[model samples]
Target: MRSSLMRSLHAAGLIDYYALLIHPLTLGSGARLFEGPAPLAEFELTGSVTTSKGVIIAYYARH
Candidate 1:
């Protein structure tokens, strides 16, 4: 989803000056959640598997 800050920046033609802050990704094998008015749907994404203790145990895709 687009953030309000991004919209404001774009309106002022300052897109070059704005950047989305990135954070380190958590390693895990779980479904990502996206909620809307309707039912949630699962999309294909790539990542790593994680255990109960937050340890990365395997690849998201077996192949």
Candidate 2:
């Protein structure tokens, strides 16, 4: 599963940069990213952008 893989990557300290895109619509319910029991990882905002349609693209790097 993707969640498991992400968790493993987090545990191994292999993630340097993580980016996520947020749309204007909400799903109400669906798979959530970054869901796990591990401690919260600190990330610094590297960059971000918004499209004409209102979609936000965010970029983050581990701190």
Worst 10 residues of 1 by lDDT: 32-41
Q: CA lDDT of each candidate?
A: 0.38, 0.84
**lDDT, residue 39, candidate 2:** 61
**Strongest candidate by lDDT:** 2
Candidate 1 Cα outliers beyond 4 Å, as residue runs:
17-63
Model 1 TM: 0.23
lDDT of 1: 0.38
The segments of candidate 2 whose C-alpha lies over 4 angstroms from its true place after superposition are: none
Report how far off residue 34 is in candidate 2 (Å). Answer: 2.3
* Counted clashes in each candidate structure: 0, 0
How well does candidate 2 score on lDDT at residue 33? 77
Highest TM-score against the true fold, candidate: 2
Q: Give a tens-digit lDDT track for model 2, residues 1-63.
A: 387897789878888888888888977987767675676788899999999999999999999
Error of 2 at 39 (Å): 3.0
